[model samples]
Target: MNLILLYPEEVQASGQILSLKDRRFQHIAQIHQPQIGDRLRAGLINGPIGEVEVLALSASEVQLRWHLAAAKPSPDALPLELVMALPRPKMLKRVLQTAATLGVKSLWLIHSYRVDKSYWSTPVLSPDSVHEHLCLGLEQAGDTLLPQVHLRKRFKPFVEDELPALVAGRRALVAHPYQAQDCPAPAWQPSVLVLGPEGGFIPYEIAKLQEAGVESVSLGSRILRVETALPVLLTRLFPLR
Candidate 1:
């Protein structure tokens, strides 16, 4: 980990000493290889960005003195919310990390007709695993904010019930391979972009999403994996520069 992360509860009195005994200790000792008095950027999960001075280390734990000033705000909010088909465990980890890096404000992992049912049972869906990936992404970009993630196990009900409220005034685009418009330029208003499974959205799924006011759109004629297509969509829709 480039930067160490702590939750609000981890910060001790005087706000100077923070004890880390979790995976972060291993990352610092083995990966970062910091010596005593080595200062590293650190932050609370939903709180502030600050600096930590390494005070001591052992095989399984590290102690640091923290100095927090102000928390860093997110770079920018994409006018986009991602509603994606559940990808495999490995891909899910990568996508969640990338989405956090890209400043996606919200993510909905929904079941789709083509999605593998087994993907829902992955341990990666646990709170700690998800937080780990988000922290990695945040550290990658020197960011402090975390994205909100939602899980939807039923495709039709999500499209019919939860989706309408989320997309009411926002432009909604569904990425499909055929007979759809191209992804649009980022506008002043927020948007919601839906992506399909590895095999793409089935007809009924597409129809239901459309019925809920999601417009069909495409990256191109060529198909891309969910991981590849997500970053492309984020970059295309919200060009950084």
Candidate 2:
């Protein structure tokens, strides 16, 4: 974990003091091995980045006094939205974590013909699981803002009824392998990118997305796994800026 993320409930009655007794404590105990008065980089979820002075430490728990360092502004999130056709259950977890780490503020997990119906029933779809993976991403990137994840099991309704407004006045693109326009250079404008499942969107699905004002774009001739394509697409569209 690049940053020790703390939630509001962890704060003591004084607000400045925090008590950790979960996996975070184990991390401090095993990985950091910090001592009393040692300072660690810490941040409040959805709040400012700062440091925590270790007041007490042990294997089961640790107490730290929160200290918000002035002049250290929390990084701004990317002005982007990712609308992806839900992938396999295993891949979904990794995708969610990557999304959060990359600073995608809005994530739409939608259904497509290529998506397996059974994948939707996985336990990872639960709020707790999704939040956990997103937190892992935030902690990795030293970020605090959790990306908003939306699920749409019905593909047509989301594309026909709700997508137009989402893509309106923004650069909207959907990944397609055949006869698609080449992906564009990175621009710091609000954008919505739709990535398909493993085999990719069916012809009908692509048409539906096209009708919703989403232009089909291609990465290359080589077909890439959803996991590989995501980071590549996002990188090409919006770099390390």
TM-score of each: 0.90, 0.95
Error at 126, model 2, angstroms: 0.4
RMSD, each candidate, Å?
Answer: 2.1, 1.6
Runs off by more than 4 Å, candidate 1: 12-14
Tens digits of per-residue lDDT for model 2 on 1-241?
A: 8889888676533338878899888888888898789888888777777888899986578999888753155566887879999988999999999988888889999999988999999999999999999998998888888789999999999999999999998899998988799999988788999999988899999999999999999899888998888889888888576
Best by lDDT: 2
Each candidate's clash count: 1, 0
**Candidate 2 residue pairs in clash (backbone atoms < 3 Å):** none
Q: Report how far residue 116 has shifted in candidate 1, in Å.
A: 2.0
- The digit string of per-residue lDDT tens for model 1 on 114-155 reads 878999999999998998898888777666778889999998
Which of the numbered candidates is closest to the native, going by highest TM-score? 2
